[model samples]
Target: MQLDDALHAAFRREATGLEGIDVAVYEKYDRDPCEPIIGLGPREAPIGFFGRDPGEQEVRWGEPFIGAGGQKVREGLYRAIHGAALPDFEASREVGRLAFWANTVPYKPLGNKAWPMAVKRRFQPLMAAVLVDHWQGRELITLGREAFLWFGINQSRETRQALDAFWKRDDRFETHHDTPLQLENGHAATFRLYPLPHPSPLNQTWYRRFPDLLAARLESLDAARRLG
Candidate 1:
């Protein structure tokens, strides 16, 4: 938990300067505003998910990806794996445990907006460390543009530009991109990033398609059998 300690300490130092976060909800939960609200699966999980941040439901539940938007993703996984719909929130969360789940900031920003890029940068190294040190899987399903492009945070200029270009392509979601990342501990690997739209009710255009898109992704990964 050294990385957690380090990240929490760093967050405490800079959280006062941060804006666009629901301080009241954190207060209500008696949760330290600086604590990262992450969702972690068992170390044996075969795949991981990268998201933007937590929401009100996440803060209330003391975990990420349990809100309405996350429930959609969870339901998709369960449906794809079990060939049936999720029966309840508990079952959805159960399916969530079959994979790794994390986010860029791991906190709830105000109005459910994405965390500021500056905050994401401050915690990027430790976040990367969490993924590298905990998860043995290199395949990640990144939800939305922010989650996918976050891989380029500390990468070279050319790499960042290329990732942006890839995001704009028509076949972006159907394609998988490899992003090379190195932890401070010298562990390096290329993580396979599969792009997908964020499954939020607020995202009207793509919200309806998220289930089908996610089902295809899970099928392509053979995730059901792997999890089984």
Candidate 2:
């Protein structure tokens, strides 16, 4: 199946639960279509950020990764790949890698809010399907703890141990010595699973080194590809 079609199906399946939520407030406001919270492009593309909600008073655009955080993420991506403040997609396209973005949840939660654990659980499988179908079994570079947890890669005793070590050492990307965590679907993949602090302005300290970290990860991917 084409990745977009797969995503559409997965999103529909996952978002079925949203219909049951008390959307009375949303109904009071005009019911415009919820914009897609993910973007799918070629396999080699950079995946952008996907948040749970669009800002108030903003027109919902079709693509994911719009607004201030999107802008910062774009800037960071450009700096990482080309050492520039902005990426010229036309130029980047010539280098043979493209970028795509997706979110675990496809709809904006009520109150411009964080997703509930139950909601997140319902949505995660669809998100995983999108990742697996689109990336075709490639290792993922998840951006934050939420993404890691949503992708089902952060539930091991070893991972907890690693986090404990990081707490003691005050290191961000603490090593787990290759721990394996099982996903809902029972398919397993091993990843280095770097734990970045969230990129939100609320966590400005984490955002400072975000670009460099992403660049280094990209470089590692390149080196691994060469070795393979």
Best by TM-score: 1
Evaluated at residue 211, the lDDT of candidate 1 is 90
Kindly list the per-residue Cα lDDT of model 2 for residues 1-228, writing each as its tens digit: 135666576666655546533245335555443333455556654332333434332224434444455555555555555655565543332332245556656566656556777777776666655655455334444555665555443356766665455435455543322335455667655444445545566667777777666666556555223311
Candidates' TM-scores?
0.91, 0.65
- lDDT of each structure? 0.83, 0.51
Q: After superposition, how far is residue 110 of candidate 1 from its true place, in Å?
A: 1.5
| Model 1 lDDT-worst window of ten | 1-10
Residues 1-228, candidate 1: write the lDDT tens digits.
223566667656666657867888888888877777777787768788899999888888877889898898888899988999899988987888788889998778888777777888877877887878766788999999999999888777877887898899998888788878777678777899999999988789889988989988999999889985
- In model 2, the Cα lDDT at residue 186 comes to 74
Worst ten-residue run, lDDT, model 2? 89-98
**Pairs of residues clashing in candidate 2:** 45-98, 45-99, 46-98, 46-99, 46-100, 47-100
